[model samples]
Target: MSADRRRILRTTAQLAALTAAGPLLAACGQEAATAGGTAAAAGSGPPHPHASPGTPTVLTPNRIPSATPSSTPGGSASGSPPALPPLAASTPPEVVTGPRDRPQIALTFHGQGDPKLATALLEAAEQHGAQVTVLVVGSWLDQQPQMARRILDGGHELGNHTLSHLDISSMSGDQAYAEIAGCADRLRTLTGSIGRWFRPSAAQYATAEVKAQARRAGYEHCLSYDLDPRDYADPGAEVVQRRILGGIKPGSIVALHMGHQGTVDALPAVLEALQQRGLRAVTASQLCS
Candidate 1:
């Protein structure tokens, strides 16, 4: 063969060999790229879409199927809230207590002019198993020494109601002090024991000065009431009784005038009402002290 023909035949054979190997090499390259892509997607041996930078996914132990939703960074579903502790046992609320645990109620009489009625009240109280506190006017005590002594001797408490039952609020502070102190002094002298309880006339209007003066004159406190029968105005026995029974409570101080017949009439029912509620009627001193 000639040298040029021999070279041409050699080139043609080389071209055919190249064409046959092209498809095989392309398929091998494609297979290698696909394998690399799969490894990257699985987040193994390379960074991938499934992987977050600098974050470690720690598998929790004993996780339930329900717990999977809470595993997300900002997931709403979560473990149960912490439980609240039980409340401790508490004491029942009290209406209120006095110096003594036993319930006491006061029956205070306003005026002091009638000694015969006062003695009758004291006797009635004794009969009904109740202690009494007599608020005496200064002149009344002076005028009725025998009756005053009887009340003192009978072991009843004495309270000053003012010298003339004057409206202390209408007077100057000095006058108010004198009216209270004068009566208190007479009461102390006659009874031979100082009184600490005072009830203003009509539970009348007064300033702090009256209270201050009473305190300065060795009085402890004023006696007032949660229940008022208004027996003094002679509203009638039934009305007074209803008012008292409806308003009465434990540790309440009841006010009624000894001078009124209505009070005397209402006393028996009032006592009955108190007894029904398991309360014992007592003097103001007993209530306070």
Candidate 2:
């Protein structure tokens, strides 16, 4: 594996271990509490679908493998998607993939852009028997509050991307706190919870400050992805499809975008490929659960 891949896998494992040991209680929530008042213990979260023994629910995810799948019977991740339970408080840093032995992957989206496009992608995922996660921008959620319930109704997961979708990693501590909590407030107002996950905006990974803010905002883990097709660049559908299909592996967490037509166009083929490869597309919590 490449250094980047190795680093991702290692970090994910360490974070997961720390969470299981229950050391995640001391982040920013002690420093700056969000208006959403996520006073629940840090690391509390929605239960995972196939989590290991003692793995915390909604704790950030696992490392992915690069190998292809075998033609094993019932490896089809064709799941009877479970209705998402109320998410507990957020957990710590990140989970990039699940156990390597499972033929599962998490398909996560940045929730912004056109709602129609977002709905289309949801339909595609549903039709293909997939469950996904959407880390939404607070402002966008303000624009389309209905999407919160829509996503849940479809058996998907919703998390915070940020309040303003700004360059969150570079912001001052107070600024970052507001960004994380602002979104928490919005999600709480619309969905009755601050969400169980956080992802930094405009960066591939969360900085220490951003993670601290997320922690303070009652998020235990920051969601991260291993596969990015860069669909935001307006690459054609074929390119989007090829990039993801070529790179995806077991327990992979994919970063994709909404509002791009090419990404919308690429969903069908991606779903078909995963099914053919004996892999199932699932939400991050489900993949790590």
Candidate 3:
């Protein structure tokens, strides 16, 4: 194989290691993507050939190769779709390819009201020189305006996680609209600009009703996770790190809880491991490009 192809293969191997270790605890969350099925972009790097592993770039994902139906029994009597060409060098960054060859992962935090934990997460990000995004509850902002302000002042991105966090899908039309729009309003007032993104509670978006609600509320897109650290459930630090490192792909929006202690414990390793892999940690919006 050419050197570029070899690098792609090595990268694919790393992504496989992540998956074998399990994903970031997204039990049933819909895959988060731009309208065009793309991952966000953060920075620039080389164009490697289509290899598998490490983490797939969300900005430009290579669909896992599918099996061909045979001419024999139990196969589609019809012919198969043509084999997908291998990923090309110089694919567009906005296309949501998996895992960056450059060191970078966007660290996402959920919940509000706990300034200590919030500060700790931010401090960790700063200590490691990683970019961070904090998704704050509207009420959380009310209780912790200083924390919210600190996040923005610290150069982190602050996003909306909805007011009251009622499951948008289960809510009535007006209620869903209120939940999303209310939060956006609060965030805009708190941070000046409107929130650039919206991530649903539990990473769930059950219907078009909720999707429309978010969009109408002025969100660019609903945020979902490709890797879930399961920090919310209080997984051990080691477990969280293992799951994230094993499962994360490039352009993956990793979900962790700002409300939980395990995530706080795990943050350092997560940052360290990312650095060791030459991945730079950034905010969700920056990754979205």
Candidate 4:
């Protein structure tokens, strides 16, 4: 062949080789890009849709660390506590009982008076492995600031029972609003969230205006009781225990008081009776939710 022809033949061969290598190189680059994308995704994890900004995500319902007192009331076992759904506007204004078919009961206390009595009540419940809801008066919480944290640390629930334990049903709209909001404010300050329940003072059920005020204060449920043992009447411990055990049924919300020594004394027997009947004593939130 002539020199020019030979050079032309060599050039054509080199061009064919380059064309054959293009797709292979492109495929390799695409594979590397995909692998890098997968690794990046794996490292970052999935987006948390339900997480609140600036708040630690609670994977389980274990007791949150108390903000005061530097100690938990009673240490909790290692397990997921029951989760309570967020309060919604459509939630019932008053819940007198929980699901009737469930063998669960909620024992709620009116929180006021002597702090020592409150502590004793809590200790009694803890001994029986029971969790109760406390409707704390704002003035009482003001008197015993650490008590709010204590209730939470003990794995119990605290709720708003108004500011001064006033008869909110008879108050003006603004006054009722203040009653609810004041307690809510204290709870939020102490726990980073408002309470889960609200109960009207000096009344079994909240009035329409009171319920509206409670909703405005961030409480969706106003707790009422299906069973009232009249523990506040200073009934003897035997009477208190008899009253509770006599009327209690599945899903009953038993109303009691924290200030009564008789109620505290009756707690052990009441808890034992509940166990004998195969009913679990849970917080109001747990039972209702």
Query: Top model by lDDT, which number?
Result: 4
lDDT of 3 by residue, 12-98 (tens): 999998897565544323355432244223322211111122221111112212222233322232332212224335433222223
lDDT of 2: 0.74
| Candidate 1 structure quality by residue, lDDT tens digits, 1-289 | 9999999999999999999999999999999999968844553221121122232222121211111212323222333221222211321111122343567777766645355666676666766777766777664554554555565444566777776665665566677677777776665555454565676653443357777767776764666556666676788889998998888776677666766666777777777778788888876656654
Query: Taking the tens digit of each residue's C-alpha lDDT, what string does model 2 give over 1-289?
Result: 8999999999999999988766455554545566224534431232221112221112111111112222223232222223444433432356655557799998999888788999899888888999899998776665566677677667788899876666776678788888788777766665556767898887878888888888899998888988998898887999999999999999788999887889989999999999999999988777766
Q: lDDT of model 1 at residue 108?
A: 67
Q: Candidate 1: which stretches are off by over 4 Å? A: 1-102, 204-206
Scanning candidate 1 in windows of ten residues, the lowest lDDT window is: 58-67
Winner on TM-score between 1 and 2 is: 2
Kindly give the stretch of ten consecutive residues in candidate 2 with the minimal lDDT sum. 56-65
Better-scoring candidate (lDDT), 2 or 3: 2
**lDDT against the true structure, each candidate:** 0.60, 0.74, 0.60, 0.77
Tell me the deviation in Å of residue 72 in model 3: 68
How high is the lDDT of residue 225 in model 2? 85
List where candidate 2 sits over 4 angstroms from the true fold.
Answer: 1-92
Tens digit per residue, CA lDDT, model 4, 1-289:
8999999999999999999999999999999999968954643332221112221121111222224542653543322232455543444769988888899999998887688989999989998999999988765665576778678778888888876665677777778887788777767766666778899877889989988888887887889999998887887999999999999999899988887889999999999999999999998877866
88: Cα error in model 1, Å: 30
